[model samples]
Target: MKNSTPKANFESFSFSEDILSAIKAMGFKKPTDIQLKTIPAVLEGKDVLARADTGSGKTAAFVLPLLDNLSNQNVYLRRGRDERFDSSKRAVSN
Candidate 1:
């Protein structure tokens, strides 16, 4: 049997429009190898421990999927003077 392959492009990650727009605006043509490997698990709320050299897109690897997860929820108010994002553990200013 063949081993499972990771998703190739950022589009395959099924990110929300805002995230996708931000990615494009940032000129990220695609995910890095590490991102392709771990984003799915991260989005699934599974733990991940990765080590990569500096500037391996590691921050984006975790941040993008985490942001996507957060966006999937109605965690923030539509309009508020003090906007916040509520999570299971804590809430943060928007």
Candidate 2:
């Protein structure tokens, strides 16, 4: 398999300048697989359900895009176990 870490960069995601600077300052040279798959979806305000190893940079995958979007108030983070939305959707559809 190809090594995603070597070619995966935060720049391709089109993150804000501040976030990009912070990413550099934080020494995150490249994104893990999970981050690569999740960041854009989350940034586009889509509901993302992703799973990865504990140390696979899951936190930053969601947090960075969220922080950049905070100014526009477009953040809504829901966990995988949050089934309340499912129940509500069923009820409304019924």
Candidate 3:
């Protein structure tokens, strides 16, 4: 299998401190391929459809940018927050 590490590290991107801290806490030292590919699109408010085998950090690939987007704006709350996104566990269930 090809290596998945991206050329950029977590801090290389202009992520807020909260996201950076969370990534660090999660022991994520580098961006996986999916993360590298999807994070920018997600942050740019572009719709993304991604597929990868299991254990590919798919959850974080979306969740980190989602959290950043949500934190950067309250649009979701104005539209009536979806309970699914209220918690990570709940998000996966839906």
Candidate 4:
């Protein structure tokens, strides 16, 4: 992971806006133990392997960070059908 730091206890870090929004929508007020440990590591793009008892909030740990990064990208959709078709053809040919 770039800019890796010492692993932090789950209670120490804060989540970004989109994550907090989704977490609230899912009715989670605080981070679970796995969430605490995994979120920071994933945010740093580090390779992680975690094992936990079933029904833990493992899905949110990864989903939140991925959504956050994708939302921040400077991507613009194609403006016309021709542009979209051209792009798709290029992708398929490549």
Candidate 5:
């Protein structure tokens, strides 16, 4: 998808404050054309299928948007239970 807004340095795009801080700390100052095009679409919840030449910053295009979603959701983390409680143990013994 083409953007009507003229491309600017990636730093100029308004992002969530945390995301912007992390991007700056990672030392990225500009967006490659793929990043410029894809990030916004992904942020807007569009399913994107992009084709780009090697080394065209495709990784950042996907990574940044995905990270944004994950960070926003603040997903839960849980530990597994002991396997010894399984009902299959009784079936196997029988």
Candidate 6:
């Protein structure tokens, strides 16, 4: 049977600039098999379980979607408080 997974691209999904920038900075050319499988399901709020070799684009698969979700909700997370804040870093109340 033919495989049914639709091809995915970072630009095809509605990711924030920071996430896309990070992806570019990380030199991610495209999604790996694991990433291709996991990213869409995770974005859809579905649980996924996958395993791939080291150096696979696993981190991006999870982090990118989570960052995108947070960005959509107007919750920006940064490591250092000393850094200047942009509107992307606005805190949202529940």
TM-score of each: 0.75, 0.66, 0.68, 0.63, 0.68, 0.70
Cα RMSDs, all models: 5.7, 10.8, 8.2, 7.8, 10.2, 5.1
Q: On residues 23-78, what C-alpha lDDT tens digit does candidate 5 reach at each position? A: 88978878888888888888788989998999888988888877767666745443
Best by TM-score: 1
In model 4, the clashing pairs are none
Runs in model 4 with CA error above 4 Å? 1-14, 76-94
For candidate 5, what is the lDDT? 0.71
All candidates in order of TM-score, best leading? 1, 6, 3, 5, 2, 4
lDDT of 6 at 94: 31
Lowest summed-lDDT stretch of 10 residues in model 5? 85-94
Count: clashes, candidate 1: 0
Best by lDDT: 1
Whole-model lDDT per candidate:
0.79, 0.74, 0.72, 0.62, 0.71, 0.73
As a TM-score, model 1 comes out at 0.75
Lowest summed lDDT window (length 10), candidate 1: 83-92
Compare candidates 3 and 5 on TM-score and give the better one.
Answer: 3
Q: Residue 38's C-alpha lDDT in candidate 6?
A: 80
- Residue 34's lDDT within candidate 5 is 87
Q: Candidate 6: RMSD over Cα atoms?
A: 5.1
Q: How high is the lDDT of residue 30 in model 3? A: 90
